[model samples]
Target chain A: MRLSLLSDLNEERAARRAAVLVTEVGSGEQRLVREGQVGSDPLAKDLEDSLRQGKSRLAEQDGLQFFLTVQTPPVRVVVIGAVHISQALAPMAKGIDLDVTIIDPRTAFATPERFPDVPVLAEWPDTALPDVGIDPYTAVVALTHDPKIDDPALMAALRSKCFYIGALGSRKTHERRVQRLMASGFTEADLARIHAPIGLDIGAVSPAEIALSILAEIIASLRNERRRSA
Target chain B: MRSTDTDILKAAEAWRREGRGVAIATVVETWGSAPRPVGSHLVIDEDTNFLGSVSGGCVEGAVITEALDVIADGKPRMIEFGVADETAWQVGLSCGGRIKIYVERVD
Candidate 1:
């Protein structure tokens, strides 16, 4: 058993309370699993359940016992429009450990200089998102006011099981966007999944305040909040 | 070691050095619908105070009570779950499977 994996079982020393440990099974390719107090990785939970039923093999992963404690790791964030909001949003998002990625076909906006720690993609949404795999744990936010850059991503999020989707625009712009989406094939249910005119009714003015509101909404969504629509 | 793991271990080891009783609870085995994997744990002090979780909140009270008793006796135990135990899920372990917990007290 790898010594790192034994850390899970060892931490429970006699009277010490147990903590959950989640380790990625593979090193080369990323296969992240959240099995502890805060890891809601659906597949990880499934695998843990399967093993708990008389299959003790999971107890010996790579010759190590593998669960750990209650810390919720970072969530993945995909920003489709690399606009001013993202310039402000990425840093704040990183503060909470959400691995932020800004995608834009415009080379000028999508540069490492603009986004130091974050990964920038000078590619369009259709190509970028598939590589990212907008999983259930992924939160997608669209900040571009332009339809050509934002539309494809909104469509992709609608089709996937992403945890959160937010788009920036004025009410009128959103209304028009809705019409266009309806014409293109989105149902009321699909449209309902978006938080266009995004962010809570926080009355945010500056880009930073707006970013905070957006993050708040994402947190609320992660907690599965339901709000009555106007 | 990962910072999170190190932080938790430091807490555990400190308690042990203080001459306070400690027991490590490990999810040694799990099946069907267990919420935690085979290595999940819930550390418990002699007072039944805890630092981690194995089955959400389910089985915790029992584990705590057992933990206190283990502290008193200095005996280690392996508590099994799932096959037949409503008490474990009373607070909420409806994973519908079993878990084997190796609860060991550090001397």
Candidate 2:
């Protein structure tokens, strides 16, 4: 907990970069490993494992036990449509430790009174997604089936390394939507990333049920991706 | 507020910057019916002020008492707690489980 190390940790946090504070339990010595450096450090493999799981852990290397304190930025859930489903999804996402933001151009739907305590951005996705700053920690969800709104948002999310991208529609609707994206120059692999007919198939009949399914699917995807990389 | 690990770390840093001695207790490992996941944190200041949680409410009192000592002694230690069937009614951890928590001063 030296002043220099504190400054380093704060700087990385300000930059929204992931890092780990490694404390040698025996000696009380410490080191800050930035996300980029985790791949090359002597504890590279262990560090990567910690980062992938997004959990701090005690790692023993050569009989030396070190506490890896993980410092990851907050996970963001950006819902493109401030519709009924979003009304249910936003608060649920926040309940599970995600920062939720709902975006829609329609002021009638995207009202502060409707979504209390949630940031409702009354702007188009093209203008608002950049302002929101999508990153690997973000999960983008398109609740609106409107192609004009959801398409641009999907493109923006796909361009970045956002952890989850989901769009609300039926399987048939997704097939037609896939055709549109393909015509717009998206590859098969890129289009494959979208969780079309978004959410787990839980027989969700109500908006709240659908919202629960979507969040569950997103969490499952996040954990599965970590396992895949780990 | 959110009770996430990041919030615990931020609170620890802020408390230390405000000249309050801080100790952080982290759940290093858990086995069987543990309430909180490994890596969960409970940061306690010199005055017994704390944030976040390591085991829901199963063992905060014991952890906080150890955390106060850790902040004063500047020594780190691993402490283990387990629920036994004989004392299940006496304590809240009716479901049996064991957890190891690492307590250290945030210096």
Query: Which has the greatest lDDT?
Result: 2
Q: For residues A1-230, could you state the per-residue lDDT of candidate 1 as single tens digits?
A: 12233344454422233233443222211122333432454335535443232122232354544433332324578998777888898989877656788999999889899888889999999999998778766789998788999999999999998889998999899999889999999998999889979998899999888989999899888755322210
Worst 10 residues of 1 chain A by lDDT: A24-33
Per-residue alpha-carbon lDDT of model 1 for B13-53, expressed as tens digits?
Answer: 66777767877676666778877765455777786667767
lDDT of 1 at B27: 69
Query: Among these predicted structures, which one has the highest TM-score?
Result: 2
Candidate 2's docking class is acceptable
What's the DockQ for every one of the candidates?
Answer: 0.08, 0.42
lDDT of each: 0.68, 0.86
lDDT of 2 at A149: 95
Off by over 4 Å in 1: A1-73, A225-230, B1-107
Instruction: Name the candidate that leads on DockQ.
Output: 2
